[model samples]
Target: MSGDGVFSSGVLSCLAALQRLMDGNPTVAQHVGLHRAKITAGIVSVEAGFDRGYLKKSRPAHLPILAKIEAARRSSVSSSISSTSSDVKRLKGKLRLLEDELATVLTQRDKVLTQNIQLWERVRELESAHRNSNAPELTTLT
Candidate 1:
């Protein structure tokens, strides 16, 4: 096939079908028997009304289409990686905030516990002093 005539009706349709698949078009997804994440040359060809063997033959005419498909696949993979990285960063930030909050709550709890202990000690001492004062005076009969 001549370079100018490389994009026949079948090739054009295949490219269109690939774009639709990548864009998550539900109808195309159903026709191709695969979703965007699972797009392959065979599925694209089939969706374009070509047999699976059309792309498998690796004709020079198919180079451009194959290149486009590979590029799309690489783009999708990189985007997925970047999105996952962003998600990890967001989760790490949330975890740090929660850790800081937990530390603050623990400090407040320790302070409250110490105060309670001091108050209980003071109460016990006051009770002892009151008991001693109320005791009968010692008898000093000469």
Candidate 2:
């Protein structure tokens, strides 16, 4: 489609994408499925009108409706992307909090283990001292 926005598969996608970006409407972006920069080159051909390009010319009348459709599509798409991004950010924050908690727990475990080891060593030393001290001396019988 030319300025009118009537197009088949490839042309329609290109046009639709351009329509989305230039329009910056979420509804169109959703339908087009990409960002604005990506659509720019494709729109170059469209800016010239379909008559200048390989694709057949879309009538001028269709442009306004197509633009409207693209606008709505882009608007919805933008909305979805914005919401999804916000969700991802929230999830990332939660993940960071969990990781911090995990680290704290691991450090506590290490400290407890060290304390246990020290206690066990002290007990062994005490038991050995008691055995040596309590043992009776033996004299050899001739």
Q: lDDT of all the models against the reference? A: 0.77, 0.59
Which model scores highest in TM-score? 1
Candidate 1, which ten residues in sequence have the lowest lDDT sum? 26-35
Clashes of each: 0, 18
How do the residues 31-63 of candidate 1 rate in per-residue lDDT, one tens digit apiece? 544434467788788777777767744576677
TM-score of each: 0.71, 0.46
Tens-digit per-residue lDDT, 1-142, candidate 2: 3454344444555455455555655343232445443443324345424332433236453455445445655776797799899999999999999999999999999999999999999999987887799676556799
